[model samples]
Target chain A: MKHIKTLNTRSLQESMKKGGCGECQTSCQ
Target chain B: MVHQYRNNGYNIVLDVDSGSVHVVDDLVYDVIAFLKDDLSKADDAVTARFAGRYSPEEVSEALEEIRALEKNHQLFSRDIYRDAVLDFRNHPTVVKALCLHVAHDCNLACRYCFAQEGEYHGVRALMSYETGKAALDYLVSHSGNRRNLEVDFFGGEPLMNFEVVRKLTAYGRELEKMHDKHFRFTLTTNGVLLDENIMDFCNREMDNVVLSLDGRKEIHDKMRPSRNGKGSYDLIVPKFQKFAKQRKELGKQYYVRGTFTHYNLDFARDVLHFADLGFDQISIEPVVAPADAPYAIRPEDLGTIKEQYDLLAQEMIRREKEGRGFTFFHFMIDLTGGPCVYKRLSGCGSGTEYLAVTPWGDLYPCHQFVGNEEFLLGNVTEGVKRSDLVSIFKSCNVYARKECRDCFARYYCSGGCAANSWNFHQRIDSVYEIGCELERKRVESALMIKAALAD
Candidate 1:
């Protein structure tokens, strides 16, 4: 296993706008 | 021109060109329709239609009212998109995002998965590092001076190709300085393969991470199970909670997205469950399955679905009032800047602003079309063929559909999703009836919430 590294997260406000409908079921689901 | 509908005694008119919505009374409504048909119609013809409803003097006055509406460009307006379409026809299309299907295999066997055992009806495969790199290069070169671009490392399970994802994100970072374009990354996972390293990388470079946990343990385990028939809910919950807390601490965006099927009619419980589990941002959507799929949300489920939406709305409002507000993804209707007609009509960007790449580098309009060759636009090497893309852009928009032209929720819901349209009606432009009803119910719930908030 690779060494686990830490990453920073954007604020919840900034986070809400990301992602796309790259999957099925869940989109309409 | 506009799309108008009579809803509950109110005439809802959506100005197609401007994307403005107007709600008016029966008198104003009938006059607008009459003027829309023929603004030059003599007062007698108007009187003949409404002869018993109103006196001749009233009809004359209504004609004046119609003329006023026309003067304001609210009725009998000229088509605004004709010239705009011609100009765009001469211009080039800019590609902003590529949803790369990095892995076409999954560890879980979700009962309602459209991917067909995670194979997409083809042999399971993982996207090569070279193909992923070329997709980024393709986006940079064809991006047309766009400063911002997006790349979604999507799959039956993106982590199945964890090494490729790690290398791809690193390579994209390296290319950013040289190409002068910013790439926003997102990953959607079922959370079956998330570990310390994968979660770390995802939290670091990935702008968004969609953790698929369908609400409650019982519901999730029942709906989504491992290929070996083992429940995955127990394995994922702790990992997801830890990762989500880290993202929240860093202020990064993430969502716990799940799908509700016919079986989970009380779907709002899923949202409440997320809330109970300390998840603030959530997306609980209805399932999209073949009509005959045993778990499909049937037409009879509409009423309960709607009631559940209302219950969810009430809970959302109560949470906000208590200062513990959480976002239910679908209930998010932009009350400001009504989505433009061109955007609303086309629904999801599909072949226009968005495109999906298969594991082998084949390009389709969106992720849903990866296995379906009929929707193949082109490959990363050749770029999107102009003729093929143009055909999709021209044919897939809501403006091209007849039923959508007069729908009350047309402007808000857009034309609906292309994948759903193709799956339901076998045509890209035709939206599914279930999607339409669900959207209308959501819009209605939103409106109800707005009313309650104002009260």
Candidate 2:
């Protein structure tokens, strides 16, 4: 009956990264 | 695919491929689930399906909203990264990170150490300056246009080879200016030899330092002890507390990393223990060991572990409200600005961009795969000899693993740790089922925390 919010509209894979591992799963064992 | 779940009294719908999350009312939640299952049915059938509970008007409105979201490409979005992933290996392989095991020797004797007390199933040795320099040179040469490079000084304990760590860092800093590249150094230590001098140097140089402390004196001392079987908690706690405070004063980052095994299923208390100790950045992870090992987290522990995650998230929300918020590594998520498609599909870049170098300069995919001779890529001096193996590692993605293909947390974890998969199944493109379950729960708890705090 109701839509509260849309957290993200853009496709996450479409973004660009400048540097750093960017993000690919790490809490470094 | 839409993965719907309720947590912290909120119904969350995650459109897997598109990475879009929708928080909806109960009626809309049911309507979306219905539409996902039978998309061919007309709007009338959808309304009739839920007619008993929700009014026809409510169903109609929910359908309209879903349709609008679909039109806007926010719901039920198609996979656009499939083609990109299929040709993943063809892309240039650039080495950007190195887990330099400076010392294949440890000062502590942790019971569940995967590295076998730091020797990593090999002879105990310290990396010579020449070998460490060669590693830095190899990384720079193979980096291929990546300006920001990460070098984690890992080992049985990096501090055991403090002189070598310092030398390698200085060498890396020198190379950075000449090559127009920046080095981000991280050190993961057991905090056994931590002192004022080392702490000062770490605050000045290391970008991030991971201090190992298993929390709660009883739990920590039992798991992580010295060569003489003496508890290290008494020796390390005061040092860690001072180090954490100094890092905060210098505006640097550090984490008090801990490991919780089956012996302590109530790991949430340990996480709180870190918070109460005035350490802000904390991470208490589930210990990874053979399933038969007494300390290993078994299949039966899944339910209790998930509950602990929920409890931790709720407590995190409470702490934030009380102005005592601290960052829990696993609970952090960047829904809006997450990884790019390349990073998401490829994963942590173990064998490709990131590789591990042993003290004697032997190379492996990562630290976890170091001891396994089968995973040896080559030596740092020779560079990666197994380009075919490198290609295989490069090809590993969410789609490569069958279970990961359908897993809701696939993109979030990027097929989980390849080493973990290889350890269990002898295959990189596989799933660690237990880890998968815990990851899903953590993701849900993270989202719930975000929602609760937003309120």
Candidate 3:
């Protein structure tokens, strides 16, 4: 298995997901 | 669950529970699918499944590699936060950001504006300094232990009440000093009343400025026009360009934000147009409107929209290779450290940790919910009046969202927008399927771009 990126592995309490802030939903707000 | 997909000639496997991403060979990818949730059957499955394709030695090697990753606690990680998330949701949170509607009025009429040209389904008015000051005070007082606070000057046009914005900012600074807090100010403007003084002040005081200009001249003009029925593109574009340039030079953050409606299915061109116009930081998003609206994105447009994202991603990679890469807001993925686990599950602290204050100092869950009276939390002078509403918002998490429970992008989008769900299904816990589809595509495209750049 070739690891690409593992942002968090220590604990689920500190996990960081693979996307940025979905600010797209804040359209014209 | 390990969600695997192929994009741009790369096989990607995402361990949903652990937030681990892997790029593996076709044999390992297929082996993972066969193994599914049972690691005990990995040896038997790998050998039997790939008998005709991969040799015994290659299958054994791939199986060992998979076992090594699993041993490292990177694959098949259990959902440790599943139960804790419920506790996290119930815990009281202090307000960290306020989207202050400084003016419920706008100079230009944006046809797709959710705020109904800034009046928010109410009378057009500017927020008084007293009201803004009270809003700041409320933020400072309620923000326990959190040293940094955010205040966004949002409106039909914040510049209409520019003086109030200036005063509120000054007052916010003073409150920060007194309360030992730091205020990060942001301004979202339509750019009609953006003058030299405003630009200078924003550069000096505002941490980020969001300038609205919807793509090309014709597209933007058709959607955004003045009360006198004149297009606003010619007036706003030059100002926005100048503002963006100065922000770039000063090392401040700003973006030329736009919206894409059904009128522009070829939205990729508009994104390229923004890039060509010399604005590096940009965001062009799908417009959220009622399905019956003439410009609303219909179900049939999904295919075109997803294609646009793919096209935009490919072009962005090309630009990066040419050393002229611009940051697309949605495409930015922080590999080192993204938002914390709580943020990933609970989403943007919309109603709980972040609230929107209207011109009259009344609070709502967020700016999008301003006009809806049922969502009124309370005025600044009086604290959040409806604790029940707060509880309801607190319950909004990825786990609580039925549609998001099985979605692979659930952690990324955090169950999509609550306001949007409420608008569409009248249930905050539901999901907007269209937004979900687009979000998934964007995530895939972003990962593909990352892979290309890494190569």
Candidate 4:
């Protein structure tokens, strides 16, 4: 919360949901 | 056109073109919004708006602050692309990650599989070594001035074609030395065919391994049973646990992911279940299927999902207080260092930046479109012959979508997934409402959790 500056809504969704693509991180399942 | 949102005594503004965000306090918030509403409005009118509470001198001082923000280009919306990246569209494309469908054949039959049970609606076959090599070459050559290149050995199960996977990792490494590019590999598996040999090889060669273990045993077995109709949890748990331990020791990247549907509306329990199992990195999401699909999270169930997210947040906080906190992938969004406003506005570079190559050397936008030839860009052999489709997605920024400009969370979500749009609305620019609602709920929950933690 220390001045949360970034706001990537789609990445937030991908981080939560596993659309079966893993490249987002190294990235997904 | 700068837009504003007031939350928790902080003002958050979005400059659509520049993708700049500024967090200011009450007085400054008013000053920014006042000028944004009508920059030409006389200072006397602004004094009347904040009348009695603030004197004219204070309004005049606030005007000074407004000018400062305007000077910084944070108060007004204007195209900053030329200054930021300098003709990004015309810039060479960089293939950072290539999802290679090593085996078109899958061993399990997940009821909700968008890949047509892993065969991708095609004949069951594995990628010939020739195709796999060509795809890797395609990834390397097309990757413009990028040092970090990634390959996801995806399939019905990547383990199905372990030999090619083994061969490709070595081949990719060889290419890395020749091309001076670093190749990072990932293996996404259902974990049915995992063995000591495969695990050992993966631990040594792979950068990250995405093991699919739906949170709860019962729910997973029900949704993702093997061809012989038996629970995979029993077979996968020990191996997955072993890998998790190794990942922790090596500081490697890995996540145990699951999907929650209409059936598991109380999905927070699944998050707890994973934590209890001693897994630290966890991500759970709703299934991306159509509304009419039997297991879709319908409108009525949204409230329940929201409640579950809230409950999960509380549990995470409680565990942290008790010194057992874990990283829930969604809950750890640090906006300060996230992607720039433009990237967030357009979402991931799926079709344009990332390409999924089938075992037969065919290329689709991403893995989701592998079987759907309508999205087929071309084969790896042909090299993206469809510039028309490529331009369509390349031009798909959130501003281009009419509905996104008015959305407060639009800066974060962009315009949702293109594949999802195509599946749900038959077009790339259309939004997927279910995914959008779920995203909004998750973003809300994340902000609430961040606020609580800050407190």
- Top candidate (lDDT): 2
If you assessed candidate 3 against the hidden native complex, which CAPRI class would it receive?
Answer: incorrect
The C-alpha stretches of model 3 lying farther than 4 A from their native spots are: A1-29
Error of 3 at B56 (Å): 1.2
The DockQ-based order of candidates, best leading, equals: 2, 3, 4, 1
lDDT of 4 by residue, B1-455 (tens): 66666543445555544445555556766766777767888878888988887778877777776666566554575543432322345455666788999988888888888887789988888998899999989888887777788888999888889999999999998999999988889888988898889988988888888889887899899888888888788888788888888888988878888888888888899889988998988888889887888888798887888778778887887788789988887765565455544455546677877889988899888898888878889888779999788888777767557777566567567677788888888988888787777776666566655645554
Worst 10 residues of 2 chain B by lDDT: B82-91
- Badly placed stretches (over 4 Å) of model 1 are A1-29, B1-90, B337-342
Score candidate 3 by TM-score against the native. 0.95
TM-score attained by model 1: 0.79
Q: After superposition, how far is residue B213 of candidate 4 from its true place, in Å?
A: 1.8
Model 4 chain A, TM-score vs. native: 0.21
In the range B1-455, model 2's lDDT, one tens digit per residue, is: 78899998989888887788878889888888888876777998887888679899888888899988888767777677777666654678888889999999999999999999999998999999999999999999998887888999999889999998888889999999899998999999988888888988899899999999998999999999898999999899999999999999999999999999999999999999999999999999998888889999999998999999989998999999999999998997788767666666677788888899998898898999998988889998888899889989888877788897777787788778888888899899998889898999988888777677766
What is candidate 1's lDDT per residue for B10-66, written digit by digit as tens?
Answer: 355544343334555566567667766666777788889887877788667767755
DockQ for every model, please. 0.02, 0.39, 0.21, 0.08
**lDDT at B84, model 4:** 30
lDDT of 3 by residue, B69-181 (tens): 78876777666776666766766678889999999998888898899888999999999999999999998899888787899999989999999999999998899879998
User: Looking at model 1 chain B, which ten-residue stretch has the lowest summed lDDT?
Assistant: B337-346
lDDT of each: 0.74, 0.85, 0.84, 0.75
Q: Give the true-contact fraction for every prediction, in order.
A: 0.00, 0.44, 0.24, 0.03
In model 4, the runs with Cα more than 4 Å from the true position are: A1-29, B1-86
By TM-score: ranked, best first: 2, 3, 4, 1
